[model samples]
Target: MMKTKKLIIVGASGFAEIAHEYFDADTEYEVVAYAVEEEFLKTDTLNGLPVVAFETMHQRFAPQEHSVFVAATYTQLNRLRARLAAASKEKGYALASYISPRAFIWRNVELGEHCFIFEDNTVQPFVKVGNNVVMWSGNHIGHHSKIKDNCFISSHVVISGFCDIGENSFLGVNCTIINNIEIAKDNWIGPAVTITHNTDVAAFFKPAKHEPASVNTYRFLRIKEE
Candidate 1:
């Protein structure tokens, strides 16, 4: 078994609070501190752990003896985490990765640091996921797919085999990317949109909306919304 460390989590509030639960359940981390971006901190002791000053956390808990994880969510999860990661790396602290015990990952998969893979996600063989990525619930990451750094993927999204998603993209819920396609950088694919071919860089796609047909002559109270 891997030994536990006296840990500190950056981004002490909001979704970081929610992520604390998973670490709390695992024996691999003996969480000892929480730190934020200075402006949002309020006297420490998040979930009973001391909220240490960000700048002095290393002095108090040296990096060689302890490690840090950035727990911020996807709204600004990538950018903020990347910033703090640079800070920690300079101070000799290692960025942590968390894969939920309930997630299913095949052999030969490569995941970079600071990734959070939540429950019910299937990462197939020969897949590669880059740094600071967040894979939410029930995602299907097909064989040989590559998701670049800093991407946010919502629940139930299907990334088919051999597909490549560029860096910093946002994939909405129920999004489907067809096999062998490439979704370019900074793209925003809306929920339930099926991507069938290679998308241009910075492409934005939205679900198609249809107007309701004329009301049925016999239907009185069940008309569509205005």
Candidate 2:
């Protein structure tokens, strides 16, 4: 909150483009450039910002002067973001967090470094968040929700009150978590999963069904381990 901050978006993606709107609308940070990996550097301008080589963008604007944020959306994309953060640090540039102005976050809602929160996210009171949490648009994080570190929550997720989301968990689009639920670490909650209770640690819940006569692998796969 000292000088006006400048940002370099790390991906030339639709998600990145959408994030630009939130950044522009909410924060005082000005996105002066867009950055991509050497291979994905297509056009020069994204959202009217110059496209710079992510590999060396920090040379022009030192991390002390400017900050960077990742904008990828894939489940595995967070690893790459972590790498980018390391790379940026090597260049002496710090990673940044973008919290939307339109989002309703109550006081004492803890946020860690490098968290990206988009518009329309209603984060209630007593919510605890850890580092590297990417919460996309339109999420309702109910009160007393505890989100562990390195969680990726896609758009429109409804996490009810007292939900405990574990570390490295990936909650896909439109996922719903009922109250008092404790999702264990490393669980992949596939899109539209309405979780009502505690899930086993390291579980993968994908909505699967049978085409008639074919074994319902989803149902069959639910049997307890021998």
Per candidate, the number of residue pairs that clash is 0, 1
Model 1's number of clashes is: 0
The lDDT values for all models are 0.83, 0.83
Q: How would you encode candidate 2's per-residue C-alpha lDDT over 1-226 as one tens digit per residue?
A: 3338888888888878877777777787788888888777878887677898888776666777788877766446356766766677677777788887788999889998878987899999999998778998899999999998778898999999999999888998898999999999889998888998899988999965536856565667896555
At residue 71, candidate 2 shows an lDDT of 75
| Candidate 2 Cα lDDT to native | 0.83
Native-to-model Cα distance after best TM-score fit, residue 164 in candidate 2, in Å: 1.8
What local lDDT does model 1 show for residue 129?
97
Candidate 1 lDDT by residue in tens digits, 172-193: 9999998999999878899999
Positional deviation of 60 in candidate 1, in angstroms?
2.3
TM-score: model 1 vs. ground truth: 0.86
Over 4 Å off in model 1, which ranges?
Answer: 1-3, 207-226
- Where does candidate 2 clash, by residue pair? 63-93
